[model samples]
Target: MRQSEAIACLREKGYKQATLVLLFAAIDQLAWVAGDKETVGNEGFKAWVQQYMVEKNPELLSGATAADLWGARCGVLHTGVAESNDFRKGYARRILYASNYGQVGSNDPTVLTLSLEWLGSAFAAAIVWFLSDLEADPEKDTRAREKLSRMLVDQQP
Candidate 1:
């Protein structure tokens, strides 16, 4: 299924955590698929992370920053814990959102620090921007179509 369709389904159902996880996974998966799948916790994935965060965190993406975010990703996917010490330490506990910290715990540059709402917005915005890019580049559009088709359809005969 298209990432846009998945985003729409999440928005329609108001699936906050699901949306965050799905989009984060999508960005991470692209990095691995196009970069190196074995570089999850290593410095080798830093470039991919930087590229992925360019849409929202461009001015702040770096090796250290990517590692911090990867820690969060690891906590969720590998450990089933959503706690990132780097993230927790990076952000202040006092940042308020309607008298609370909001869906995300912090807004610190050292951390990914994105709220559920922010994730939805970023995902939607990135999709739009990327689609526009594809429209302008037929090669990219064709490659994406082929890749997506290979993913969604069984090729065994």
Candidate 2:
């Protein structure tokens, strides 16, 4: 549901920042579905991302990209901002540069910029790969299935 909503929000005007936040939350949900209770934090997300990208497609979600996503997630989730260093202890925080993810193609190659479309595509690809992995070996991937089952049960009446 959240993944679908996030994708949908992408097409809406002035909702890119909100959509990016949803996207990162969806990524965490994927980790939870994969039974990653321990490494679901900032660093853990990157570690799993590194492995997932290497195992599936390194061109899509590289380590540097994951790192930038983590930083952005930290900034948004913790400080209500996109840059990690732009937050301060005050009555209100600034919401500058809502576009957390920019265009990877046009971004400077020397600088690591987190692009919304690229990460979304990479995340979608990762999800497809994970589903294929489950179909290939249910036993090996039972952790994710079990976790998903738990989530479903928890959400039940």
Candidate 3:
């Protein structure tokens, strides 16, 4: 999809933090690919996501930090390593829940409203990053960087 259309769809989806995170992951993966061809296919894109996560978090799940868990989820989803399921059972739901939350109640308002708020802010920052055209205009990109930096610095708990 086109960038504007994709962003509009995201906005329509209530801008859920998880979806934003995935979009950023896709953008990051696309950025690192040397050419457009390398990024246009599912297999290459999946490998890019996995490599990005590995570069960011070499340990994968065994020794992954909280930040690493987010990358790992993107890697797992982008990779169609396994498929098929049983009606009586549910593996996808289990993976989905695990990928989206670090701890139980971590994303829910009732358990920790602050976390949800912070997640929204993080996703907003990611949106800015995903949308930036850094190569075409460095000055504009720098301003965007400063804006995001200020947003993050102000958000410190």
Best by TM-score: 2
The best-first sequence of candidates by TM-score reads 2, 1, 3
Cα displacement (angstroms), candidate 1, residue 55, comes to: 4.3
What is the Cα-based TM-score of model 1? Answer: 0.54
Where model 1 places Cα greater than 4 Å from the true spot, the runs are 5-15, 29-49, 52-67, 84-112, 153-157
C-alpha TM-scores of all predictions = 0.54, 0.66, 0.29
- Which runs of model 2 end up more than 4 angstroms from their true locations? 36-39, 53-63, 85-111, 152-157
Candidate 2: tens digits of C-alpha lDDT, residues 107-133: 443334444555666777777876776
Ranked by lDDT, top first: 2, 1, 3
Residue-by-residue lDDT tens digits, candidate 3, 2-92: 4435544664566645454555454444433322342334344434434443344332222222333333334434543222231113222
lDDT of 1 by residue, 49-94 (tens): 5454544544322223455556655565554555655446653221
lDDT of each: 0.50, 0.57, 0.38
Model 1 worst lDDT run, 10 consecutive residues: 92-101
